[model samples]
Target: MDSYRNSDARPPIMQGSPPAMVPPRLDWDRPPWNRWAFQHIREILPTAEVWRGTGHRHRLE
Candidate 1:
């Protein structure tokens, strides 16, 4: 879908080799920027892996 986009949404914001409308570091949670920021958070922010499993099982009700 290289040439397909949803008409309801604004044209692509951050994309391409250099990307567009790169939101400021302090504006990711604000209007206009939040739309894209919230969608691609993993790529924009520094993150660490979390242990989501019970490493040691214990008897519980």
Candidate 2:
């Protein structure tokens, strides 16, 4: 895995001016653009808060 961590590694997609190589688009369903879009879904899609409550913790089976 260390071989994949080089100087040429893809930089994190950030807000503001778009990075080179990665195409920019409003539709996140496409490739490359979807990579950043999916990672930042809260920024693009409508979201709501779900209350889990401070009750007993459920164990996963």
**Best by lDDT, which number?**
1
Q: Write the per-residue lDDT of candidate 1 for residues 1-61, one digit (tens) a residue.
A: 3445654567667557475657789888899899988888877798788876968877888
Off by over 4 Å in 1: 1-21, 55-61
After superposition, which runs of candidate 2 have C-alpha atoms over 4 Å from their true positions?
Answer: 1-16, 19-30
lDDT of 2 by residue, 1-61 (tens): 5565675767766845554433454667578678877777677679889998999989989
TM-score versus the correct structure, for each prediction: 0.48, 0.41
lDDT for each of the candidates?
0.78, 0.69
TM-score of 1: 0.48
* TM-score of candidate 2 against the unseen true structure: 0.41
Query: Model 2 clash tally?
Result: 0
